[model samples]
Target: MHQLLSRTFKPTFLKIYNESHLHNQKLGRETHFRVVIVSHEFNTISPVKRERLVHKSLEHELQAGVHALSVIARAVDEPLDTHTSPPCQKPVV
Candidate 1:
């Protein structure tokens, strides 16, 4: 999956988190992911577009088995800010 994203976006820095442990999943299984992608491709792009680009790149994996993907796509020139999300409200099915 990292290979796919790297090839597609050519990110300067990419970090992928397997966050299945935060839900009802076994260790080492892939069902939820958080992606921190920094790339020149996102320069000046809107948040929605960044998400769209990422989603498009991971379309196959999302369809195959990845239940959730929390994307934090950033531009190389963008300012750094702490990103936080509310805990999962719905129980993992």
Candidate 2:
């Protein structure tokens, strides 16, 4: 997925997180992921389009393994405030 995004979006700041552990209690493949991508390509695009672009880039992964993806796409020049959120607790089965 990172490779696909790198080739297609050429992001300025890209962070791909494997959040599969969060869904460990669920019955399915461990394919959940979260992507935080900052790129110049997103400057003129809408949020929906940004997601579409990412989906398009990872078409194969979506078909093969990835079950859920949460994306945070931003423009290269955008100012993003950093904040630390609370850690996630393990899900009870």
Candidate 3:
């Protein structure tokens, strides 16, 4: 999958997380993953298009062992602020 994404998108920041451990039941193969891809290629593309590109790139992997995939694709210039938020303070009772 990493190879496919590298070849297809040439991402600046590509993080592939193997999340198969979260799944209790096995689904044929142990290939559940989460991909966080940051690239200039996605700057001009729509969200759906970005997902399609990923899916197209991993077509072979999808057929082979991969089952579930969660994709978080963004342009290289885009900051990952969404993943980090200010801590919430507890209210006094």
Candidate 4:
């Protein structure tokens, strides 16, 4: 996933967190993710457009059972938010 996003975005800074453990799904499943992407490509784009671009780039993964994705896309000049996803309320089995 990280490689794919890197190829697609060419971001200056990128972080991909696999939050699958925070879910109740089967162990080792790569279902949930949070990605922070900083790239010049996003400079003049609207927030919705940035998200759409990221989503479009990961279309294949989403189809292959990526259940949830949280994205924070920013231009190179924008401030980054490093926070990750909230803890899951559901108990892991």
How should the candidates be ordered by TM-score, best one leading? 4, 1, 2, 3
Pairs with steric clashes in candidate 4: none
Give residue 68's lDDT in candidate 4 (0 to 100).
94
**lDDT-better candidate, 2 vs 4:** 4
In order of appearance, the predictions have TM-scores of: 0.86, 0.78, 0.77, 0.89
lDDT tens digits by residue: candidate 3, 14-85: 888776656643554467777889888999998899988888788888898777777888987777532422
lDDT digits (tens) for residues 17-79 of candidate 4:
888988877778899999899999999999899999999999999999999999999999888
Residue pairs that clash (backbone atoms under 3 angstroms), model 2: none
What TM-score does structure 4 among the candidates reach? 0.89
- TM-score-best of 3 and 4: 4
| Clash-forming residue pairs, model 1 | none
lDDT of 2 by residue, 1-93 (tens): 778899899988888877776665365446888888999999999979998889888889989988887788888787754333334577679
- Report model 2's TM-score to 2 decimal places: 0.78
Per-model lDDT: 0.87, 0.79, 0.77, 0.90
